[model samples]
Target: MIELGKVEYYLLAINVIGAVVYLINMFLYRHTSNGQINVIVTITFLLGGSAGMLLMMLFFDRKAVKENMMSRVFVICIFIIQIIILLIYKGHHAEHVTFAFWKFFADHRMLLIYFGIMNLVTFIVFAIDKVNARAHRSRIRIVTLLGLLFAGGSIGGLISMYLFRHKTQKDYFTVGMPLIIIMQIVVIFYVMNAGW
Candidate 1:
């Protein structure tokens, strides 16, 4: 019989609460706008952690999930972070989980740095493109934007799209970016699981 600790209990409680909130919002507030509902669901997933994210994904409001790229990206990111933390906990069995996280961070410092730089560059490019669009100047190409997204900048691209309201209405952007993110997540999980 494995005794659960405070962290385990807390994770379980949050997941249960998040699922309840999701179901309540889904059934009782069916008329709410996707944006509003997404806000609530995103908050729920953030609080609920990985299990909550999985539950929401499993029992998602399909229309909402389809329409809201930013929310989807945000939820995926939260899920990835929580999963990484859980993996670190399991790997090190450290008394302090933070130590485990720090160790992992140290081990993957270069990869993290690369992602940080790529995201920053992508964000700046998106901002520049938005400015260009506003000023009637030459703009970045769609191919370039998609390329950046493919190169570990999907998070930055999605965030910039939301913040700058650039290309938000375009089907390619609305659909493509999330798909890229999901692919990236899959590749990452595969690489990690493969011990590469």
Candidate 2:
């Protein structure tokens, strides 16, 4: 049996609860505004990804993750699922929103700006960690990195990982970061599909 830490449990609780509420809002309000649906979907995937990450951490053995080809297939499947969800939402709501996805995104410029800022911050943190590592100074904690990733910085974190060669060796960074990206991608698509 896999044991989850207190923090992990708390995160899981938040994800599950938030996802439920978002789903409820999606269904209960049949005539929900585009903006409201966008926000709800954003929150849903953000929490859903966080929860998925926690579940993976609790149940996935590090050795298996590191060595197994099947695990890679699983990750790809998850990514595909996220993409399909986005496509479905977009297809269903396109008539309700902009004629094109690009215009839909333009309508939600503020969400993109927020994501840009978070990614920038995440990138800077990784850069700072790299510098500190080279200088032989105290390192930034993994928890902080993970927190930023959870808080909408997966893209930045992944870029930093490859760009700075930081945290690449760790199982969490390689595996968990992609999972975070999957969720973030869902959020991005949710905004793109936001009915307006």
Candidate 3:
């Protein structure tokens, strides 16, 4: 068995704390943007053992959703449909198809833990810039932030937006966020299987 040490013990405690905090924040997310993430989907994502999305919710100001009530309803409809499709896709190969994704993630828990840390560090840097970048504003510099925003840190970027009251705008999402989500998926998949 692996030996326990003070530093390792402390790190485990920190990770558990971080996971709980992120989970609490997730339920609070309902920004009037892309849509509220679906419950089944969010549960699957969480069970899939990835904490990145949960951490993302913690940083967004759900109240800033610009549209009115009807818009939210429309968004919700789309959101549910998208989630259903994602679930079917991820769980397609398993007997309990609805939960196939969860089993897969459990099998690759190491990669999920790795992904969680990657998101946390990137978000901290983004959060720092969210506080410091306003005065030095230039389109080019802003572009770079947007580019980084598209680099597997959508959750962090979203979190930074609300926590700093920064980058919560629509376009930052229309382009940057989706790209980052795609990139994150690709990276996670690579990391999950690259060495095996």
Which candidate number has the best lDDT?
Answer: 1
User: Distance (Å) between predicted and true CA of 94, model 1?
Assistant: 22
In order of TM-score, best first, we have 2, 1, 3
What would the per-residue lDDT of candidate 1 be over residues 1-196, giving only the tens digit for each residue? 9999888898888888777666665665557554245466667777755466557656675554334444445555567656665665666333332324345546789977888898999999999999999999998977588778978998998999999999999765787788778767655643444343
Error of 2 at 67 (Å): 16
Q: Looking at candidate 1, what is the lDDT of residue 195? A: 42
Instruction: Using lDDT as the measure, name the better of candidate 1 and candidate 2.
Output: 1
Best by TM-score: 2
Please give, for residues 41-83, the per-residue lDDT of candidate 3 as tens digits: 4354433323333333334423323332222222333333344
Regarding TM-score, does 1 or 3 come out ahead?
1
Question: Lowest lDDT 10-mer window, candidate 3?
Answer: 68-77
What lDDT does model 2 reach?
A: 0.63
lDDT of each: 0.70, 0.63, 0.48
Candidate 2 lDDT, 60-168, residue by residue in tens = 4233323332233334335455545645644644445333646745776877788889999999999999999999999887768877887878899999999999988
**Candidate 1: residue 42 lDDT (0-100):** 64
TM-score of each: 0.48, 0.50, 0.37
Q: Any idea what lDDT model 1 has?
A: 0.70
